[model samples]
Target chain A: MEQKETCFAKRVRCIVKLGGAAITSKHKLETIDEENLKEVSSHLRQAFVPDSTSANVLGMDWSRRPGQSEAPSFVDDFSDQPAGDSESFIVVHGAGSFGHFQASMSGVHKGGLSRPLVKAGFVATRISVTSLNLEIVRALAREGIPSIGMSPFSCGWSTCQRNMTKADISMVIKAIDYGFIPVLHGDAVLDTLQECTILSGDVIIRHLAAELKPEFVVFLTDVLGVYDRPPAEPGAVLIQEIAVREDGSWSVVKPKLEDTSKPVEFTVAAHDTTGGMVTKITEAAMIAKLGIDVYITKAATEHSVKALSGILKGGIPDDWLGTAIRYMS
Target chain B: MEQKETCFAKRVRCIVKLGGAAITSKHKLETIDEENLKEVSSHLRQAFVPDSTSANVLGMDWSRRPGQSEAPSFVDDFSDQPAGDSESFIVVHGAGSFGHFQASMSGVHKGGLSRPLVKAGFVATRISVTSLNLEIVRALAREGIPSIGMSPFSCGWSTCQRNMTKADISMVIKAIDYGFIPVLHGDAVLDTLQECTILSGDVIIRHLAAELKPEFVVFLTDVLGVYDRPPAEPGAVLIQEIAVREDGSWSVVKPKLEDTSKPVEFTVAAHDTTGGMVTKITEAAMIAKLGIDVYITKAATEHSVKALSGILKGGIPDDWLGTAIRYMS
Candidate 1:
């Protein structure tokens, strides 16, 4: 319905991070379930843009609800971001369960303490993560894409004492010269000593993997790869092929999943805390030490974006215990 | 010297995200090193927000870095949202090595494809991770953190439509009700669908651990915790109580740090990115699967945030590596 990208270097960019438990599958207390956030916003617009079925999924606000005591009418929090170019494809997401599931049941991670009462816990996890980022920016404006969300904690946790990194690259190089698909996630930023630290969508996926070094970093996660033992015990094993050896010598090749081996462990709704399996093999060993070749899978599985485009055509998978990391230099 | 806040609460807001690889690490130059961001605007100030050795670092720029033939500066990326609340502490970052390290080194991850710019070997490691997140947002504003920068693909990515989960919590609740401290990083956030993931800082610490649920989920890194092998190897052990028990089991039990650890894996100037140690243990194991209680530590040891406030007042640093599960309802 909105799609506008007529020109702008053809515009097709992306940077994504979404896993608030894949939109409330684990905590739906007050509201937020619009058919499971439009089935994960229709798989985040056909898995990170281009055509996205036909587009049309912007600013979705089904009227809020996380235990509603009152105060947060941030209403459907600001919207308008996500457009396109480079043949038109841009994306950004965050609000798993529409948003910090009531800001992690109201702890406010860093949202000032004492006075924030309206339904506290940092104003209901900042009003359900700003109403699940305006219901995925109205599902990316009903899918044409031309969206926009912005809030890297309002100017990206201040990329330090403002030169605003050249005004945030001249406003994303003027939204890639006026195209779009700017969205972003995680907020509650604003720190000098500490009122918030929750700013990691990989710090905006390593600053867009360092400004569009993209192609792959998929990581959907609920679980589908990397496993050897605590995979819920029993037969255990799923690594697949993380072998990245150049000199860094990394390895972890297990693949062969599906019988519901159940080794991917979560156990059930945050089994008392403490992070699992050494924190996803230490974040897949830091996305294979940032050469970025991570897959992990599970976010509602099945072809998970062509199994992440077969690890960007390198393939791998086959049951994936994988885990290999290298390039440490 | 700013340090006041004895805890009564109210005017003590905070948000600081500075990590574009600690602000252009003295201009290794891939981009935005604007003379090391004008030397982090005279080490930001306000008496350095509460005396960390006599604070005083103060600087603020919402957004605007357009060079490479620039012009589109939304009046220098629109600024206006801090009208007082006095008891403030804000710093956000991004755009250090400016223009996201040359739009992540020319090739631009995938969406700018060329066979993944030569099959992920990294031709520019995405402009050295967009100039190391603008040199960790100008080295935390050259060490006095009252900062602000923005870029989540410029002004927190935006397209047109809206509803990006309430625009990702209304860009961090309107930069914490405008006291400001809403920076963001890991730029190049397009995502109209998928392909670009490490919006990492662990997805802004998992959307602020689901919107300020933060009982604790630190990570810090540069070194200090989460080790057993890589801190340069030789007896590298630094387990320091991984714990986990209840039956999910995990063991290790403290006493290993051998002096903290800390090795974000790779990145001399980027490509071998950071989020290191496998993205700080898989985004601190998905924010400790949401119950919180994960630390990781090291942002430069020394009193290490007062030994992380004495491991945040008690238990869990090794609740036996906490692996609780619930499987999300």
Candidate 2:
């Protein structure tokens, strides 16, 4: 079938996850960080080039007719750089203000769909998350990224324990093969045991990283990266590199948990139903176990964008910019 | 699992369809008939009461306590009307100017997803349809209908011949059981052989009618009803009733192919990728064979709204208003 052929044709090469705090105002309900979103979207657009070799071949043939200097292909002047031969990307975004407030109110993140009391919260969460997805898609479009928004809840089924047993990723694959970025966000999904639960974007990114086998998985967050001490502490030090051990444990620089002198102010927003920094690190560790390089960087920072560009080009970015987690066999 | 219990808990009791031309300006690209849509939405909200017996029981006990004249059971009065016990509904809408133009341009209705040239059209069609769904949901909310939009593409799968083999109606049933109207629309769906294809709302309505045994299935369209001749023709007579035979064939009056004297100007809109009036009648007949009453009525007309109210109350409307199709055996 054409569907299978298309899926095999384009092997996904990259995954960029935009954190909720990075693109939306986490503390303020329903407020989007429009400036940061646009800036990050523009950087993302420049990072990946949609492959157009099939059309280019025809253009080359037409230009070679009789005796004439080669006519530049239509995209020659339009594109800022040459098209990436095998670059394809998928973007996963977290649900900040759109879903968090309602979800927390209903305890949906803790699998509260069985209670009739959570009904209003469920409806509001779905509508708000979708509303934000529309905005995210529009921002990406403004930057010339042919981005299409996808709903995780609508496409995936979870077990009673919130284990996703099945997910229809065919559409996502088809979109990528057609040179469109499939944009996904955190959503309220139906679960067999729980009735319904919040499926975070972090978990989705891990699933996608395994399915797509992308060379690099990037997580654009609010802070710089993982740190030896609490990020808010006066003398906290950034941990630039994290390595996965043979036993699947992470080996990153960290301060002892028993150190009472350390000030840990890793704030989880009031309405955030899902866990904050802890969840991100755990998901990143899982992805790192797959032998994929996972970069955690701050959005709207020049150094972060530069590091992202470097990763897109398949090179080592500046070490001091962000933390990179990888497997060491 | 809770999901299985919820699925079997609620049996769908009604279905109301809003036609593309009724809510959208079919001739204009992406232009919505806001006034008609709002009017129709208000009527739809009044027509069905979500089953709230389970929640009402809890609320009644709480309101009986001393010093409390009444407990605002949250949704009490917040809802447009008293929740209709054992009354639940699912709404299917057509993809008007939003999707039809792109679907036709790419010939998706004829299975065009196999070709790479139509890829852009495929993505565009999906986005446009969802955009329209957002508007529809917002309109429903304005009328206090707890409506949630579901994309068929994200929730269903079709075969090579465009037959929907798998559609997750469990979520729909669950939504109704929890007091929400699941709004579905025509969308670009994944296909086994074709890669992707357009699933018309007419086909979806028939599928839902068979799955969910609703008492009355209403089709809100731009015309009054089906007629012996084209409604625009001089001296044309509206057919009040149609009966389906034992063999599942229609007993209504139909025109012969050789009748050249007829004007035959049943205009299918320029961008309409699906079949026109003929298809609607065919689909309605199919639903009739399932032993359900199918009413075709004008959306904006006061008479049609009154007829809808009558049907909702399980009674006969005044005089001849809209055409009702049913089965005898």
Candidate 3:
């Protein structure tokens, strides 16, 4: 095991969160957004070469496409670098529509194992989320990425009153050291206080970031980025950047909007048992306070790729259109 | 959590091992023996009602099939019992051809994560086995049985020098208490001494038996029962019964076989990364020594169902034609 650990450094390059709504049809139960999944996988393949020795064999063109000026130029030079230097990142995805229905119907998140309906729901929810996890892993595998689906609940992750109490990530660490990307997802887990509860992807990433301390974190959602109000609102505007202080407080940094007095509010989808956008921002802020920048952007877009690869190449590009949350200097 | 523990009771009723060869097409990569799986699941449903209250709703016919005189008579009265009286059992299935190909090709069982091929094989093997697990779970679920797929490796199971050192079965216990059948399978897990190793379903059942202490165990195989020699060999005779003693020694209990001196010998399949038939008997003998009787019988057969339901009701039927290993009284 020690010898194997030396093959790939233990350092995690970054953590990517593929929001459920971005990769799956949130309104349709268990429906995957195939096109978005494929595009995201293709972009990931472009960003990270699997093996340094096989770099020449792939012969992939990493140049920016026509009319996509916002795409970072760093990606164009990605293929030129040695594959051995390829960055390894972890992927965390939302359950989206796959499990939310069953979870909500059974009230699994509320956690009452004594109820037969709740128990049945817990089983059904796991089946749905794990099925989606497999789909994501398969898509990544098709792109020559060795993605292993690691469900949080099955990996001995549990909570006490909805707070994570146990999270065994040794296998996760071993997987990264062995050159495999561990793809995790929101899952229904046993809770000491509630009997069973939903562990959201946002919470999973926060826990991971605290332990692995990745260089940066990327959250790919259905919308462009965080908005002052729900994206559907008429006056909703994307909050370009936010900075978190040591005291866990955050403020909008970019755009310098006049309405800084009001708190950013987001709505949770009816079927989403786990807290939705609000949870993502809360977790991101926690991560930002740890000195790790977190970027929020839409999946399968040039801006998303730019945020992902630009950070891998050392800094986020100026043209990137995403919400960047960083520690206040 | 403590309040919920009083729901179903923590005591396990039984543990069932579904042989890979019995449930899958061993020659076909990743192909499920759908008919066999469905039949076995149907038999399981007939043997155990999911919920006591829903027993009336199911209105299942638990009688012996026509012309199946060997089928135990006790099953005819199963439906007359209260639904709450239904026994709970755990299912453990093998990878069969699904993961064996990948495991053998990558030599993942030999363990060397430092080698890229080995690591890739580990990932592929996991994907194959877990996929089969999902299929089995779905089959059981379709039968109205709450089956949860619990991949050993992903659930924090590992071996040190090929000996299981970490197997957190808290979730399994919780699932059972919640009235769900926790389905586990052979998996590729991190090994402290070897970097990684294959944990066979046989070993998993043995470990589980030691922990859960179920009343009895049933091993479902493709063949009728254990033989003195390979079942396919000429003049091979099924050993009807075996008695295990405190010293970990076992001997033929019935049929008064002429050749008592010779040890039972079985061959391993080419693609089998884990010890096959040999491991099954070895583990069975150990469990028998613990005072728990174990039955090995052909799957999807009336005799198999007899062994299962008969034992659940009280004792094995005298007409059963499977090999029974029990502690010497």
Candidate 4:
């Protein structure tokens, strides 16, 4: 097919991640969180289904939430809208129960493939991760999202276990240029130094955001947002915003209106090979440094949708219900 | 991971294709020919497993067929056999019932994606093909093969609907270099002129054979072999050999014996968008022009295994039963 002469390059792009915990039963083997997947994708549909005359957008109700101010539509501020295309989005999801167990058992993260047994483990891990990616693309398709699964195991090569050596973003770019959302996931990939290693979804997002320079980077997680003292302790507060200055100094701000509530427990899945919440935040911080607005919020909620829509219309919503990470530089 | 300094580059590489009709129920949607898959993979295991005290090999017995000469062992000719690592292979499969229906529905092969409906078809076509790839890889793993699925849609680009414009064989090369079998399948991909089109497994094998220049290219199909007059006819006979010249000339030769009951039907599945037997033979003939031996035979039988193992050991069996395509040049 000939490449269409669409102005895809000029449109604002966004990277949204449905965290493993939010979309899959992370603690249960091969189980997907069906309700959560549907809800999160539905909200994504609302945010990206273009401004007018989209079949998905027609007759859909956007009821206002109590105590929240009315917000403008996500595409209201667009200067030159395409005739039929929606806002471009690339979704990268974490490998929850699907990959974590096999990766942990295989020690693929350590980059070991010297023995035949280890090689077998690498294959097993790849199979598991790919299985999850299939489901992810299927779910996205059901929500009327034009998406395709890109295997990092085949498309990426790494020398350092922590970083990809040849992180080919060309395919992803082409998919976007053609208006298809490329969905990628955590995978065990070939490496120059370690033989093979794990490339987490967070790392993929970090690299993509740097190259694409998307307007927004959202990590839809299980938590309400990043918190001041771990959401579970007595009187622990929500950290609504994180600001980084040009000099690299940063500070976290608490929600303006707070109530004394018991903090919620935040923990990683037992089988998680990659470091959990902390790593996600660190990756988000690096992306924020590149001058994109970042959000860590509970997926599939009305508040999160409002925040996402608000940012796309060119600003953080006044009644934002998530932790926002921004750069002063 | 550090690259191992193994003599993988010097190994006799082979490309095997499990024709869609051979491992999948072409008439039924998403149905797998489980028995055929298991049997073909078993034969593959026997032919490729390095001659050693490996468990899978130790338990396997290769008995000579009645009234035939005693056959040599599959790996007897190898000077040095790895204790556990098998000979490297690259497997490609057609989309069969999985993708053909969707691609036809989307007009993907015609390069139509100018509208939302067509775009959805493109996505649907992709999902269907990818779903088959997952099952193929899983089946291979069950047979003790370390394989990973490589989507041509993401890895290839074309300017024409009839042929690929830029087919990248680098990833396949790397996979072989690292001792991993990369399983690729027919897929709906981006085309410069058409927007998108289906890239068949035949085209992939043709391209890879030219670039990798493997010692052998085998297409394990459901048919016993190509016939002089379609096998089931009263006067039909098996065409056991095809020879191609460096000057692009070719000729098909018939077997010594001939006996037939009726003319066999050579039609594609109801949903298959790619051409059936004729296209496969045409692609095989193209590969033959490159001077590599090509085999089109039923996948699991002893005859196919002998031919495959014979070529790997640097000789063609005198009693070969399948149709062999080779370069006279």
Candidate 5:
């Protein structure tokens, strides 16, 4: 019991979600966006990993740099003088083109293994997602980050009625305790009520956040941040900050809304079996309610590095374009 | 409860162990014996999977060929016609050269997380073993086998005092229930007593046999079978049959040895963290004690096809050279 407490005391610093669209060519069949993935991996390495070659690796020394503004009290808990220290974190990634097509076509998310197509899709989805996970882990490994690929289904994560009910994360916890980064992705898992269903990465991170209770969370997406509408649409505006109330309702705090009556509209990808942007926001809000700040930013961007490195803790900087979800204090 | 009974009724037909030495060039680091693996996979497909292209693929249509002799009453249960029907089974493979070097170098088998080397080695071993598992899955997939890789460690498998204590095989069961072959491998798992230790594939199969109660088990090794000594040693002879007693003692059946005083001498690989040939025999004996026939034979040989296809059931045929360990009736 004493050993367990000691291990728990070294809480995970952060949980990062690598959005499927950001790392893979979502429209293509099972194709990875190699350049973007490499860039994101490098950014992750610079933010969380401490390298002697790079002096001031982000998160190593949490103190403000020259001419940097003060951080908020919520993040003050991490502003200690620990030089050349690596941050402990877990990564949950989306399946993107790797599995979405098969899962969608076979209706695996609907969950009935009695059909041969669903059963075959279950196998194909796992193979595809796990293969992507291996690629991501390899990229992280090349960047000197010790990453292990962990498939949710293989690890006994399951859902009941399309909602996660069980997940044996002891191995995941042990991996973090041993200084290894466990890389998980969206997967096809067995469901009690449905027989099988797609367990999305968004839901996975939300569950992990509730279990591990990291200091903060970051979602690296393809877009700049959450937009009132699809980013490609004309006059679509990014929502900078979302504050969640005790009642679980949320309001946009940034770009002050003159008309508060209109609820923000978000678009989800047509092929995504799991609710897309809406699910991300919902999950992020849940994490925020736990008193942990959540940041959603474009992958491989300077803003993503800043958000991941604890540089956007106090407030979203004028130059930093992303969405910050926080609890209403 | 009714649904559960229906699923359990479709019990796994057989459990096959692909020896590391048979499928991998063990002397070389992380090298797979591609030719041998392909041949073994092809044989497995032919024997277990019913392909329209190949008639009389082994295991289907259990009726003997023109000149073939009768099978034993024990195997009579499977002698009925099963034309163009696939057999349900599971595959458990060893780490081979893939993870042995990393695990041995860091003493991961001894198990201590305090040392950085051990931690790194644990990650390296997982990476190495999982990569090889992917290769095997891909090979099987190409042959139209719905094989899913399930790492023991990832699935909440753990040991206490070097013995398996917990293994949530719900997913394995679900996969089998859904007609997908769950491919498991020797893995590094957390040990309650040692912090971590290597879980041998042999041990895994034995545990599965106890749980799933397969009709038979096959061990595909590089050598013909369990030899009086190592196969390469001078004047080493193959042991055709051994009958295990209720008390767990066994004696050579076919040889009719005058001297029953000497014990079998088996050697282990220097780099294998899991006990090698000795562990195989011990686990095989335990499985045999459960009243299931256990066959040990060289992979990719006609003898292996015979053993796997249920052709060498009543007794060992002169042409089929291998070891059959059976519970004495």
Candidate 6:
């Protein structure tokens, strides 16, 4: 079969990125909270598979999460191994807490590309990522959701020099054809341009959304919604609808990337990370343009399915921020 | 299809165990002797794909050489963004390496049993295994074998309680199933009686010969045929076979199980691991009653294949010496 240049080949699709803040309790080291995880997990159940009947989900992965000190992961609760405690989730963390923390600590970077220690360090990093992926899969199974754990590196995520040829996209396309969900997430993707690139969850979703033209892209997070400023900022207002350009490009210019002196830390790519409130808004708005009706909301487990149905029913919720990015079109 | 006693079934039809001594250089972890690897890999190529035309292989995994003083695993070879040496296996590893490694290290016994890691330790381990697996796969690929890394972990190789219902016949069944050459090794496995157990290649193979009814089982190891008495002892004759009881059991009057008080570090099975010359001979001769022959020879890449085929075609080389145990009818 001639391969297509896309992440998903056919069935309806949705891209969800676990909020970093929601996953991490502290930096570099921490564990996942069971209560919070359960609440979030139940919410995803309602949101992703709302219809008592549809099997549209190709698959999912918690591409990002808290790490540093050991913490609970998405699939902790579902690991077949009998243990002390575990969590359940529909995501795959790329050894998040460890990815960034270690990257920062080890000073692992692209410049160290082809360097022995750097190479070994990245191996350590990917090991973290794959381990997290398996956990994500366990969680999905506990929820009775049929899913598979796939690494961006092998299944062809955004990394690898061959990605330029869109080989990874085709891999996903074939997966969909087989009625299998191609669960993916932010990962330590190999970069031909940069020695090593950290593909964020947001960028992963963005790439899949833009390429696959899924029914919609939903950002499930611990927070209730996008905020006017950083969620950490006191009294930050929620910006429900993210505005964007006509071609689905994010209209908000990136102020943080001014340096462009190369990515700040371990990963080579961060320019495409969440435009913050701007990034999600822009992705959703553009996806909406594709007639798929994307949703940009917070507290995903709370509204993932309902919001999905709203999008499916062509019912766009009233913009919490009062800025109608898509319907206005 | 009705699931087997275990939903996911693995037949040890054809298993290849690598000699640690072969892959590593004299206990020093600095380099991966490509020459040695090349020779061994070439031998495997002939055995599995003799004509190099059989699509019999379902998948494979090459493994990263063991770590060196905590240096990252071999997996970085597949990192799209390799941090180490100018050329890791990034460009060569097969997908199986990453996938299986992810499953294994993640504490996931198998896809059927694994979800994803939600726990930090397990998650990190999974990722590490993934990276390591990729490197091995890549190394194998570069050698022209084109194998992928398989994580015994992914398919729930360890974390769970093994059902222990193989009837001691799975190994034989797999051989009947074409292109089912699965590489086995000394790895952490799920024990039917215990929570976790590491099964040595020596033990598993012995059990297999009893049930599979193969003409003969061969262990192509790093050293030549076993020596009688100890290596330091002069005039030690190599035992070719051993005598056993009628019921396919070794009735050793006094099978000296060394180190009864050492606590059996990684395994709980009460068996002798060293100087298998006794165990192999005793066990093989016992199976000989079942009309099957067994051979344990030193491994040398150049001659392993011919030696193996020769034994399989005729009988155990007359060169081997041991107490010939037979099943009394």
lDDT by residue (A1-329, candidate 1, tens digit) is: 11112233433333444555554454443244456455555655566554436433322222113454222232133232323332333344555544454344333454443222211233234434544564565554444344555555544343322111211333443454444455566654544344443454544554554444444555554555455554566775555555554443454433445544443333221321422435444444555565655554555445455543334446554444333332334
Ranking by lDDT: 5, 3, 4, 2, 6, 1
Order of quality (DockQ): 4, 5, 3, 2, 6, 1
Greater TM-score among 1 and 4 belongs to 4
True interface contacts reproduced, per candidate: 0.07, 0.09, 0.21, 0.26, 0.23, 0.06
lDDT of 6 by residue, B81-152 (tens): 422111101111112222233234344343222322423223333343344344444444433343323333
Q: Is the docking of candidate 6 incorrect, acceptable, medium or high quality?
A: incorrect
lDDT of 3 at A321: 76
Once fitted onto the true fold, the runs of candidate 1 whose alpha carbons sit more than 4 angstroms away are A1-110, A113-152, A155-229, A232-234, A237-306, A309-329, B1-40, B46-133, B136-142, B156-173, B176-178, B181-329
**Candidate number that wins on DockQ, 4 or 6:** 4
Report the error of model 3 at residue B185, Å.
Answer: 0.6
Note each model's CA RMSD in angstroms. Answer: 26.4, 9.3, 9.3, 10.5, 10.8, 14.8
Per-model TM-score, in order, reads 0.30, 0.78, 0.83, 0.83, 0.83, 0.46
DockQ of model 2 vs. true complex: 0.13
Predictions' DockQ, in order: 0.04, 0.13, 0.16, 0.18, 0.17, 0.07
The candidate scoring highest on lDDT is 5
lDDT of 4 by residue, A68-171 (tens): 43421322222332336667888899977676766665477886565455566677778777877877787776666777788876663454655666776767
User: Across residues B1-329, which tens digit of lDDT does each residue of candidate 5 receive?
Assistant: 00111246467889999999899887766778999998888788877876523332221111112354331122222223323335789999997777877687667789875555565567667777888898888677555566889988777688887799987576788778767788999998888898888998998999889888888999998888876655666766678888888898777887655456765532223212332666677788899999999999999999898888876667788777998999996
- Tens digits of per-residue lDDT for model 6, A1-329: 12334443355545555555555443434244445444545455555553422242222232222342222243333445533211111243334353554344333445244443344344444544444454554455344343445555443333443233222355455334433334565555445455455666665655555566655555555466544445565654444444354555432221233334542221212312433454545545656666555554554343555654444345445533222234334
Q: What is the C-alpha lDDT of each candidate?
A: 0.40, 0.66, 0.75, 0.68, 0.76, 0.41
- Candidate 6, residue B242: CA error in Å? 20
The clash tally of candidate 6 reads 90
Docking tier of model 4: it is incorrect
Weakest lDDT window of 10 consecutive positions for candidate 2 chain B: B57-66
Residue-level lDDT of model 1, residues B1-329, one tens digit each, is 01111222223232233344444442434333344344433333332234433332222211112232221122222123322233343333433333333343332333422232221212123223433443444344334342334444444443222112212343444444444333455544433333222243345545545554534444433445555555565664555544443333233445533333332232111212333445445544555555555655443333234333424435533433211111121
